[model samples]
Target: MNAVEIQTHARKLYDAHGTKALAEAAQMVRELEQRGEKKLVEDWRRIQSALQQMRGPNVS
Candidate 1:
């Protein structure tokens, strides 16, 4: 799949399963890494970082 497709799938998986989805997404990223898909991995890292920020403790 292309970057967009991988991103969309990752987002949906993240929403549906929270961090539990990371295993699958990370697997995809690892495959992409092996295939030299740098941009896609960068985008995936951004998405993962965003999700982690969203789940951070609230300061109030």
Candidate 2:
């Protein structure tokens, strides 16, 4: 998925699963790497981190 799609999907997953969405988002970013799309990997990583942070530190 592109950056926009990744962010959108990540948000949805986050809403449903809370901080667990970080791992799933990371997994998705890795899949994008395997597909050889390096351009947006960093963007997705940042998004994942932000999502995790927004969920708060106590979240697992």
Candidate 3:
């Protein structure tokens, strides 16, 4: 899949599974980085950062 597709899938997974999905997404992103897919890796990072922001200070 393309970067956008990967990102979309990651977001869906994150929404469905929460923190476990985030961890899996991170691993997927790392694998993409290892494979030299920089754009996809960056997209995943963006998704991850967005998720973090959503959690804010109230999250434990």
Candidate 4:
């Protein structure tokens, strides 16, 4: 597929599963935090923020 088509399909998949992926990642962050992995938690939060931004401005 062309670049545009690939990007289109990727966005479609992300739109369908982005929230679920974020939730699962957040859960992992929580578990790590509970175990006192503060550094990892911060790293994961950065990843989560990037994903949220990609979802758009209106997202929480």
List lDDT for all candidates, in order: 0.70, 0.75, 0.73, 0.66
Q: After superposition, how far is residue 42 of candidate 4 from its true place, in Å?
A: 0.6
Q: What value does the lDDT take at residue 54 in candidate 2?
A: 64
Cα misplacement distance, residue 38 of candidate 3 (Å): 0.6
Ranking by TM-score: 3, 4, 2, 1
Better of 1 and 2 by TM-score: 2
The digit string of per-residue lDDT tens for model 1 on 1-60 reads 555665676678788988677666667678889999998888776656555555677678
> How many steric clashes does model 4 contain?
0
Off by over 4 Å in 4: 1-17
RMSD of 2: 3.8
Off by over 4 Å in 3: 1-11, 58-60
Per-residue error at 15 for model 3, in Å?
2.2
Give the 10-residue window scoring lowest on summed lDDT in candidate 3.
51-60
Between which residue pairs do clashes occur in model 3? none
Instruction: Give one clash count per candidate, in the order shown.
Output: 0, 0, 0, 0
Residue pairs in clash, model 1: none
Q: Compare the candidates by TM-score and give the number of the best one.
A: 3
Off by over 4 Å in 2: 1-10
Of the two candidates 1 and 3, the one with more favorable TM-score, higher being better, is 3
* Candidate number with the higher lDDT (2 or 4): 2
Tens digit per residue, CA lDDT, model 4, 30-51: 9999999987777666666656
If ranked by lDDT, best first, what sequence of candidates would result?
2, 3, 1, 4
Model 2 over residues 1-60: C-alpha lDDT tens digits? 665675676677888877577887788799989988787777777778668756767835
Q: Model 1, poorest ten-residue lDDT window?
A: 46-55
